[model samples]
Target chain A: MATIMMRVRQIAGIALYLGLANAQEASWRSPVNVLSRKGLVADQISTIWWFLFSTASLVFLVVITLLLIALFKKGQAVPKGPVQENSSVRPILYLGTGLTIIVLLITAVYTFISMRTLAAPSQKPALTFEIVGKQWWWDVRYEGESISANELHIPSGEPVHFSLHSDNVIHSFWLPDLAGKRDLIPGHPNSLWLQADEPGTYRGSCAEFCGVQHGKMNFTVIAEPRAAFETWLEHARAEANAAVSEEARVGQAIFMQQGCAGCHSIRGTAAQGEIGPELTHLSSRLTLAAANIPNTTGHLAAWIVDSQSIKPGNRMPSQKLSGEDLQFLLSYLMELN
Target chain B: MFRGALIIAGLAVILHIGVILISLERVKAKPPLAMPDTTGRVVSQEASSLLKHYGCGGCHYIPGIAGANGKVGPGLEQFANRAYIAGHLPNTPENLVHWLMNPQRLEPGTAMPTMNLTSTEAKLIAGFLYGYDNDAR
Candidate 1:
């Protein structure tokens, strides 16, 4: 029996080690990463989570203790029958009810405080932006600027107010490390505010199910210093830089001549199709196809050649182009920044 | 209870068989149509990528290309035999190349958008399409 017990302990230790190793290999996409807070809202959310956890744990312990006591004392009761006054049971019932009521009241107060804190607008002038939730992508536009897709940039230590809209169905925008979820409904505009305390990249996803590709509808929130953000904004507002190389010029010519102009738009060029995302500063983005893959030259070539293979059922169709044409197009796109 | 279980089991088997038979019948009921054979022409290896770049599969059904199953426009299985381009222009190599390069200039308000293909790119795609003609001897 002792040998068997030792073997069980060794097995348990191995299992625990394997579990830890697996957890370490988990990517940023995992929900387990939500424990790290980066913004003011997430801080409050974490506090609330701890409070609820402790309260529930205490209640569970108390209930389990009472149950165990009752079960063990079942045979030890005196033979006084129905005539005896059960004073002990009455006090326990009163205690349980009183504790439950107090816990509920505390929870209610916490929820009220958190909601008010979230709803209160920042006193300092917050940067205003609009984000439209499409079928499986987020169309983001800074105030009075051309639109971009899948990436949201904000200044650190400053509040940013977002006006959210939906073009087709309802989608809930959620940046777990920055703020809670907000629903974007068609014909109804909702507003949300977030203030990141640090300059870092936070990933977000469409929390609500919209369609077949809802799981793939991910985005990134980049928080930088005020100076850097302003510089980025200026760059975003500028027209596409002229192609400096011959290959890029050929690629630009192909982009304009092809049906790409029908769905995508690149400012300062004749390619003005509103069906897809704006591509004035396409190369500056970190990821493509709504964070499906890193924005590399190879990924760009593959995406341009066959976007359906990268993100199936997406609105962007595959383009049949020769290798030389694809190289030129890739060069042109990479130079957009 | 034993008899009731037997009846339920028997009914479930019958229902499962009925569903399979119905599905088989539906699959067999599709009508077959006489499709033209366009296997004679040599398709350029680069034509597939060019076709994808132009997004031709988004509107027309092109055979032998993945994701070319769009139904927005007419299928291009035997396009070589078609006498006119876009139902009006005469079906010549020059006309096809011209139509590929400038769809809007030839016919404004047409559903097909102008896919600015260069002359060389357009000629290559046209060649690949024309090579698939079944009637060509």
Candidate 2:
């Protein structure tokens, strides 16, 4: 018996260690993990979650213990005509009800306090970003100047303001690790203020069912130091670089001649169209097609040839171009950085 | 009572099948737009296919085309009936072909883009637009 107990203890230890290791490695990076918080707003919410969880767990333990005791402790069966409560069970019932009420009142008060804390930021926001939720993508702008798509950059350890707008339909912006969901209604703007305590990348997505590609509509929030973020913004505000390589020059010509210039825009060039996301710094973005795939040369080539296959029902049409022209186009796009 | 319930169930099955057949018939019916008459006018028929191939339906609501319900641009249901192209140029066959070729040159800063349409393709599209109007009348 002693040996069996020792074996069980060793197995339990290994299970606990594996569980903790998995939580630390994977759960912190998951956007929906409310417990692994990196922002001030998320921290407050986590506190509330922990409070409610602990209280509810204690109540569960007490109830389960009583249930087990009642099951084991055999007693004379009560007559079954009219339900009669025994005097012994009366005390247990009163104790259970009283404990339940106290837990409920505490949780209610805690939730109210957290809600008030989450209502506003502690300090004035140092930066403001205007985000327009387009169909299957996000258009991010800083002070109405530098424009980017599907990526938002901000300085860590400071409150950052966001003004959300929808170009077509209603979409809900949700980055669970940084803040709660905020709806972006067309013609009706909504504002949110969030602050990250540390420098990290938080993934966000459209929570509302806007259209067919709602699940593919994802964005990234990159938090960095103040100086680095400012430097990055300055670069993002500039226009595209002039075509340097011979292939890139051919690619630029193809971009203008083909229908690619019809719906997309690249600043510093004459390819201005408001129908699709701007590709002024196409090479700099971390992902493509609203974070559905990584931004790689091969992936980009596949996307340019047939974006419909990558994301069905999207706005970008499949291009009909020769292999050489496509290579030239890819070269020019890579030089935009 | 069981017999009555069985009779009602039988009637419900028949009604469901009837509704499905009617809906299938409606789905098979042709759209309410005049197609380009394919009588020796091969360019117009090819132009209609080109419009779908170029994904024009992704932006404009062109009639007689399946899945062309886009709301970004104005509907092209009665293209030949419009007095002016893009609200300025007089609607003519030649003018329409030019607009289709170089939309940016005619109206600078216009949302209409200069696609990679050849002169022949532009003329074909114009012919199809006029042919559709004549067939409709």
Share of true Cα-Cα contacts across chains kept by each model: 0.00, 0.00
- Candidate 2's TM-score reads 0.63
Per-residue lDDT over A1-337 for candidate 1, one digit per residue giving the tens place of the 0 to 100 score: 3444544554454344434433321122234245567888777888888889999999999899989988888555467556776676698888889999999999999999988987765565468889888878888887755557898678998788888988799999999888888999999999888888898777889999998888789888889999999888788778889998997999899998878888888999998887788898898887777865556564566567667755778888888776567767877998898
What TM-score against the true fold does each predicted structure earn?
A: 0.63, 0.63
Q: Which docking class does model 1 fall in?
A: incorrect
- Write candidate 2's Cα lDDT for A39-68 as tens digits: 888888787788878888888998999999
List candidate 2 stretches off by more than 4 Å: A1-32, A80-88, B1-137
Output the chain A TM-score of model 1: 0.85
Candidate 1 chain A — worst ten consecutive residues by lDDT sum? A21-30
Residue lDDT tens for model 1, B44-110 = 4345445744567655677645556555467887777788988899998889889988776887645
In model 2, residue pairs whose N, Cα or C atoms come closer than 3 Å (at least 3 residues apart or on different chains), thus clashing, are none
Of all true interface contacts, what fraction is found in model 2?
Answer: 0.00
User: What DockQ class does candidate 2 belong to?
Assistant: incorrect
Give lDDT: candidate 2, residue A193. Answer: 92
